[model samples]
Target: MSVKRPNPAQWLWYAVGGKLPDRYREWVLHDATAPTWLVRHVIRRLVFMAPILAALYLVLAVMMNFDLTIVLVGLGLGVYAGMYYSLIFSTHSVDSRVTRHGYPDQYASQVRKALKQAERDRYNATWRNGGATSR
Candidate 1:
């Protein structure tokens, strides 16, 4: 026996309700590759992150005004923020690569290749100029 597929609109509604639309999976997967869909995905992820960050900041600030417990909570939040930012923003970082492109591994490889080519060009230019650099 064969299963009937659900309508695309119904699938979207189900998806919004946190349910997987097995019937429309192929169509959804195909649409995910479109530019508009990709942009929407990025915006959705960022929108989700912003609220959590704001809440964390608010909780930390409120805690800092109280007693020792609050102070400790605030300190923990500060450490978390510092580590998170450092890991996300470090040179040639995975998070940075992902944000610039879409996927981490693919973007990392591309960045590595670009850096290697740039270094090779600089080396060749300096060697041709007898170790003198060009601006």
Candidate 2:
């Protein structure tokens, strides 16, 4: 089934770590526990950063009359710091989001763990056992 997703504004609010309405609850659960959830989460974070970074650049360059080089350097440092901190709390943040959506705590983790078990089993079969297996 095609998943019901939020509108652009709702998505942006979600990206900004704001809570979305109940109508988009299923979409939020799927987003927090999809097969590529981690990558998707990282992408959402980058999406959240882009606009903020642009605004920061604008404020520094225009409001403060700073040089382009200084603004760029500051933006670069900010991006690095933002990503480092965001990633450090990636799982915690995602889990918290799931709970906020009315799911039990660590629900995303449990779902992802079950989803990954098949892959782990295949890896163990292919390499851990032997390169060649009886069919």
Q: Which candidate is the best by TM-score?
A: 2
TM-scores, all candidates, are 0.31, 0.81
Instruction: Point out where model 2 deviates above 4 Å.
Output: 122-135
Model 1, C-alpha of 121: deviation from truth (Å): 3.7
Candidate 1 residue lDDT tens string, 1-135: 444445666644433333344554444333333335435444434443555656765665564445656656765676567556644543334333243333444454455456668888898877965686569
Best by lDDT: 2
Candidate 1: worst 10 consecutive residues by lDDT? 92-101
Clashes of each: 0, 0
Please, what are the lDDT tens digits per residue for candidate 2 over residues 1-135? 777899898898898789998888889889988887778788888898999898997798989899999899989988889888988998888999989989999998888888789789889888888668657
